[model samples]
Target: MNASTALLAAAEGGIIGDGRTGANLALGAGALGMAIGWLALARAGGGISTGNVRTGGMAAIAVGTVCTVLAVLHLATASGGPGTGNGLVGAIVAVPLGLGAVLLGRRALTRCRRADRPADRMTV
Candidate 1:
């Protein structure tokens, strides 16, 4: 259910003879399953963290996060070996998307905050 539990389950039931965790852990489809599901609800909550968020940025973040999840799934299930998976492809997509989302979202938030401040008025 939780990440630690998913990880323990993965250790017991993951790729044979892995004896390790890396890309599989990073991608973490099993662990991410819960997180990805919760992300949508979190976005809708509209707290300080989620309110007035940029749409484009949010979209990128969601897609990037899922790409990472798929990447992990691919790595975990890879036949060749742990590091032999094509999940790097997912990482390639996710990293930039995630970074761009952060930058753009921050810029939008700054603009929103500035707009909320009162402006000076002049009198004759």
Candidate 2:
């Protein structure tokens, strides 16, 4: 299982030693780590197939895109002005995560297509 899924399962099982707060922290960290992991995989030219790595990368991209958009909306609605650090940090992190996911997905799709192609036959 991926980091996010494993963390979520652990949270559901109450496996975190620090209770709900710890579970929340674990989930958050797992999500971020998953995103980073996917990006690294993509950059490293891994997960070119329709495998777990590719699926994870796509999921990461979706989550990252959503997170980035939500962060932007939150920042826009914040009356405390643009100096709020949380929104800024979220924006900075999410965009790259989303872009990396998209890239990995594209790479996987391309590889899958290439693998499915039939080899040329001899005319003799």
Candidate 3:
């Protein structure tokens, strides 16, 4: 698959694998889902303005990062609480989603930059 396709797939996989509705898991899952939706739309062929897609993807990345960090912090604190097991679950899910978001964001940025380059100068 192409880079865009691969990125979108990874993002979607992360989103689907994320389990929502449990302490930090909820936030992390939501963030991952948003990222997947945005990036997937961005990669789709001729469905929307590239600028809008880029903006949405960037926003998702930012939100996902914040959510991941917050989830991690929650997990760390819950180590002393009864919800430690839930926290562990969140951590397990969040790490992969967070890493995927970062990678997808980088890929989207790279694609945007490449798209902006003068077509005539593009090498085959």
Candidate with the greatest TM-score versus the true structure: 3
Alpha carbon lDDT of residue 50, candidate 1?
A: 49
- Across 64-112, the per-residue lDDT of candidate 3 in tens digits comes to 6755654555455343444534345655566667656655665666676
What are the clash counts of all predictions, listed in order? 0, 0, 0
Model 1, span 11-124: residue lDDT tens: 333533342333444434323333333343344344336433345335435544543544444345444542555344443343444344444444544444555557764222
Write down the lDDT that model 1 would get.
0.43
Clashing pairs in 2: none
What's the TM-score of every candidate structure?
Answer: 0.38, 0.44, 0.58
Worst lDDT run of 10 residues, candidate 3, spans 12-21
List CA RMSD, all candidates: 9.4, 9.2, 11.8
TM-score, candidate 3, is 0.58
Model 2 local distance difference test score: 0.45
Candidate 3 Cα RMSD after full superposition onto the native fold (Å):
11.8
Alpha carbon lDDT of residue 111, candidate 2?
51
